[model samples]
Target chain A: MASALRVLGVDPGLTRCGVGVIDVAPNRAASLVHVGVVRSSPDLPIERRLKAIAEGIRAVLDEHRPHVVAVERVFAQNNRHSVMGTAQASGIALLLAAEHGVPAHTHTPSEVKAAISGYGSADKRQVQTMVARVLRLDALPQPADAADALALALCHAWRSGGTATGGGAVTSLTPAQRAWADAEKLARR
Target chain B: MASALRVLGVDPGLTRCGVGVIDVAPNRAASLVHVGVVRSSPDLPIERRLKAIAEGIRAVLDEHRPHVVAVERVFAQNNRHSVMGTAQASGIALLLAAEHGVPAHTHTPSEVKAAISGYGSADKRQVQTMVARVLRLDALPQPADAADALALALCHAWRSGGTATGGGAVTSLTPAQRAWADAEKLARR
Candidate 1:
């Protein structure tokens, strides 16, 4: 059996950067490894804020040693004030991935939502709930950023088909996911 | 008079990041120490592209030991596709500055233009021409990006008042700058 595939996900932002790591088994059950947010005070200069984010990401990459890293793609149409900071933070993540010799992928919000909740337009709460169920967590992750990051990781694992490993206890899909799968099957027919 | 201020300026882009270093005398005469662009193939992945830019900026920072790093402040209204790359590239420059313990500043396009050409609405050619004239270069710096980088450095030096050196041979302003200065003086009345 192949070993579980470990993935690191980043939800980039200037004031709050969320990061999470997970291991996915071949049967598609995902287990959480670590999750948290790295924050920098808004009062700091742009360089200092970015420096803090960079240090936080570097620490995670060094400790987790994930095989792959996934980051949320910042869209141009987003809030003008925040988008630049988001893009900057995302850039730091991608660069750190390269520096650490890890492959990196970026997913848009819609893509992550669809992957986790089986609906492209799924709201944030729905996506977070799905993530909690998939990982068998007792409760949903706090702060939308943290949940979004885990969803990004899970999205990458599922989208990058056949990448998960063979070893690990396989957990059945949640009823909501089963319903979505059945609905998709019916639509295909 | 204060010692000459060495400033490194970055006009950030994903494919072609422009970098320039200059020394500004207290008399406000600026000399170009270095100017060049760091190019990364668009064919490379985003991570690799950002990595290339980071390495290029790091090399300049280490070699030049500039007192301050100046980057072009990217606006949200620019071409959508290029703005993200520009912001990301700008992020790398700022992060490098923090890592190296150098002060970093960002100047808007108009700010740099006004400082270099005495007009906020100066076009690319006018700014480039003025950069060459200010540095006593026989030829205009090729590629708008390189010239823009130098202009940013000069702008930072001039705007940061009373920061240039006391010992360098003083050079008088050109007729064009003199005209603008005299015009401004008359307007104040």
Candidate 2:
């Protein structure tokens, strides 16, 4: 039985976190599964926002049952206040993944674009277009952030030999396949 | 035999994530347990940074085995770029707590200050002074971020009655006691 892999991609944020899920199988194309956003406000205390992020994300993970999580890696911010705040929100995403024993894969902005658009410097619209094309969707996903997240998940689905089932693989790769698998896993942006 | 509770407080960042752990008893105050920082740079891709943050935080969690994890909540920022970047880092901290089965808590800047100091609007110096006083330490914890994280943990320790070990007696409280508890737990600022 060929395994199918479901992936969830997260674009972390304090007020608006974009998320998407995708599924794929070995030697097969990727499929867009699900996508949405988790929105928190600045007026809300950090604790409340965290609760929202955590609960909302956990709901997504449980609903999708993705085998892998794709997270956009942290980029540097010039403003200290903004950087710290963003990092805190990202922490919530990581926590959600860890809770379910799903290992998170990270990808750079450039890497996601390069994998999707054949250019590292591709713009958001171009990447979105490619994501739609790859997923065989007629229309692009709403909310650019959601589209970006879906793109990240699709990137992972395309790169990693996906599971045939919509969820994730239950088996572990051998040491020989571990490094390549880790690289495949971690490289999903 | 009474079991001591170990709490880990984290200040999440893409460049440097500060971690501090403390041990506390029911009536006795907190003691410095362990402190660490995970550093990453923009020069490296976000994949590497996420891996570093994941590995470093896991090591800390494994080594310290804290019962609770407290992280400073994300604050508002005007800069869009910085906000996005830091949000990602905070996600890492959240992931660490969930992955390890450690209950996670979050504290706002003012909540932390009010817990450390008598007032919510207290300055850093005042908060640090109170932290030193409350913890009975010779000096304020170095690096404002680390101290802030430690203060956040203390704040959680205070409101949560320390380590979540002893359940608060559901005593009928005087209006004044109820007011104080409400203010302590629900105060916005």
The candidate that wins on TM-score is 1
lDDT of 1 at A148: 90
* lDDT of each residue in B1-189, candidate 1, tens digit only: 247789999999998888999987655566889999988999998999999999999999989899889899987778667899999999999999999998788989988877777878989998888788777788999787898899888877776642422122333864335434633443343
True contacts kept of each: 0.81, 0.33
For residues A1-189, write the lDDT of model 1, one tens digit per residue.
247778899999999999999987755567899999999999998999999999999999999898889999987778668889999999999999999988888989988887778878999998888788777788999888999999999888777752632122333864335435633443343
Residue-by-residue lDDT tens digits, candidate 2, A1-189: 136678899987777788998776563456767889988778865556666777778999888788878877665543544555455566666656766777766677776776677667889998887777667777888898899888777665544446322243345653224323433443352
What's the C-alpha lDDT at position A62 in model 2? 88
For model 2, residues B135-161, the per-residue Cα lDDT tens digits are 666788787767776777677776566
Candidate 1 all-Cα RMSD? 6.3
For every candidate, C-alpha RMSD to the true structure in Å: 6.3, 10.8
